[model samples]
Target chain A: MAYTIELFMVSVGVGLISGALINISIGYKFHNKGGLIGGLIVGLLMAIL
Target chain B: MIEVFGLNLLGLIGLILFFGVLIASLRGWIPQDILPVQSALMLTAFILIILAFILGKPIGLKDIQMNIYLHPITALIAGFLVAGALEAAGAFKAAINILEKLSKTTLGLPGTVVILVNIPTIFAMPCGRILAAALIPAAILFGYILAREHKQPALASIVVFGFIVNAAASCGPSPLGGIGMVGEGMAGGLGVAGVQLGSFVNAQQIAIMMITAVTMLSMSLVFKITPDELLIASEEKAEEKREKKEGVSREGYISFFFFFIGIAIVFITQPPIPIQTILIFFVVVIMLVAKISVKDLIGGVILHPIMAMISGFIIAGALVAIGSFDVMIQILNVLAQTPLGYIGVAVLIANIPTILPMPCGRIIAMALMPGILLFGLRMTEIGLPEIATPILLTAFIVNAAASCGPSPLGGIGGIGEGNLGTAIGSSGRPQQVGIMIGTGIAAVIISFFGFI
Candidate 1:
């Protein structure tokens, strides 16, 4: 359970945090939404591993 | 000793006073130069001692001395010595020439720009000042070229500030006296076997690469920093400095080759010897090859961070004597029980260095590492996986290492700001955002790869 929690943190958790942060940094203009989406999908994939 | 919130009265006062003065100085609520954090921390320790004596709980001098871990400090100083010799030998110039030539290759300007911006992280200096000082002129030159070629004045700011952030954060992964070593040492104290000395290096390096990209992006999109807007009268002087440097000497190439080789040997072999011994050995070879004198090596030592580290140790020692760590661990444990729970609190704890950035990350790291270690230990007792230990430590160490970049005090970012003729805290927001994300990514990498 601890390992799963940690795995999620290092993957989707970080990805989501980074996405939101970049969005906030750019004032939610949505220019980098592609990056955010890509990050989520990739992060989820990494988490599933 | 009167107790309050798990801490003795004097310990509570000491902890509050210590953090209060440090945060105040960093925020400029007080005159920093007159009462720097180093002096302030030392004074706090002295006050704790006096109060401890009056309260009949005197902290022994020997106890404080014992808390001062000399391994990382010595390793850091030796690393600086080697860096200084390499600088004096013009080894970095050879590196710059390679980057310059590489700029025109198939990778082209943008690819080379990323590589150039990430140079400090690639080399991973003990002090960002070493690489920043050596490569900033190159950053400025490349920045100007980028601005002219791209016709976007902001590109210069992107490159220069991007490089600055990377250089500043590069210290985290630096195998030398870097903040990571302090964390590594603390984790090693857990008696965990097969924990290599520099386990956190790869995770930090990968995180720094991402950080460099985010910093550049933030500079362009968020801050919209422009070279023309930031142009000061000193811009010409920077250009003149760049022009004055001649071709790299043959010895520069020799020293550069040996420096990387030495680092490689240390990493690959993982010798049982102290890192300081290896560093000194390489330092001598570099000195002989570059014909650098011992006096030149002495010139490389920056006393500020060293003093800050010592002051941190002294205060930490005093705090330990007062049972402050026990109090801190209690608070962490209690916080872990709250709605945020263990993982959330752990995340917050790891990011504290960035939230309360200091001019030198070592100050916070040396002071707080013991508490952090105890907190990790507590978590493990509560069923956090053993793997989480290094993960937490890496995240915190990387954040602390990079926190200096956004500091309003005399941090490495100040060097870049001074060169670019920008406001003192102009680059703060972008760099902070980058570091915040970078730290998160570093945590992820360490956990995902089991770098522990």
Candidate 2:
């Protein structure tokens, strides 16, 4: 049971790191001018819902 | 599953929207001009109504007889009419003249505008997609004007960034912002309430604050939009982006500020009220302040009392048609109870549909929430909900971090950049891309770890 749990955690962290990187790379375009506004709009949506 | 012209009700409806967007986009090619997205949106609602009635819906407000999709249909119509009329009326321009004069003074224009005016937008654009539209076009125009002058982009970008992430990262249960919704859905999937479980029992806000600071700093890295630049461009293009927004909707101001107070009370006050109620209250205030007549307001409310209610009803109908929400819920419960940590479980589940390029986190409520509730039983089994609160909050925050970006599908990243370089027409600033990208990435990384 302990071994299974550790493996699961490892899988999750790895997957998330990849996913996060992809999302951020793609999201970087929003860095300019109202990018803050744009990104935050999306961020706020995520926070609320 | 009976076929109507080659598909069932759901499939047929889906195809109509699909083809509608395609048709809308295609028109842009010939005219080299986009279809008034208004036309496309209106047609989408029209077709949904027509389909709902054709599939054996009856007429009248007798509840069961009336088509569920009609609400969205009328809501879209009413919103467009009022907004269009307001623009034609030059309601904002009337307010603009006063600011133009004040901007000519030593204080300059955009400098004054960003502090008092645009900061409020962070509070205003909560619904994300539709509500943000009102400000997105305006923001793009402002960014272009800033680029035209030798002004650094950081100052304006930071203010906009604050609103963006705040709305996304906003805590509590308020529907006045999308961040609240994201929090709710995430908490709900874990068999918890957002304001109560994720918020009340955690240190998530600390992380958010930290991340927010970093994000702000990074947002300023590009455009070299330092305090120095504002003083330099006190006139010209800077003033063009900087005109102070006159407060026309006094009622909107009162209601919005109250809306913020209500969110604050959610944490510290007694007898918690549903944030949904708070949302309704503010929206009603907005309706009145926008000068939408009482009669029109009533009509629109009758049409759509709930935000996205039409989609809700349609999904409800789809559940019945496809079999049962109960069955999906049971499957979800089974999956959620497998001792997988909530973060991993949610990310895995959300990304599964990524192959089809579907949205994250929202659609699974009917499918995965039951499993989450079942898993909550495990918490009592081992006394973990309180113990794991911090971990759970972090996971939930991570989930809220999505955007349309460099991708063509209107991702968050792309929307942010749309105003920076290519988004500004003609004399656009391609030179600013690397700086902006660097700052945005820094913000995202900080957010990934939890707070500013």
lDDT string for model 2 (B1-452, tens) is 44554335444454445334534433343131344332343345445445556756422223322224342233234433333333323333333443344445542434223321222222332222322333443443443344444344454454344333322332222233222233334454455433333241112222232233344444454333222233324533443555444333454444444444554454344335544454455445555556565554343231211322333334434333332333433444455678765434544433321211112112222222223333344444456543233233333332332211111223233334444432421111211222123223322332343221
Backbone clash count for every predicted candidate, in the order shown: 2, 51
Candidate 1 lDDT over B17-46, as tens digits, reads 877887788778878878887788888888
Clashes of 1: 2
Q: What is the lDDT of residue B346 in candidate 1?
A: 85
Docking class of 2: incorrect
The Cα error of candidate 2 at residue B293, in Å, is 1.6
Reference A-B contact fraction recovered by candidate 2: 0.00
Proportion of native contacts found in each model?
0.00, 0.00
Candidate 1 chain B, poorest ten consecutive residues by summed lDDT: B227-236
Question: Where in model 1 is the C-alpha error above 4 Å?
Answer: A1-49, B5-7, B228-245
How does the DockQ of candidate 1 come out? Answer: 0.06
Cα deviation of B201, candidate 1, in Å: 1.8
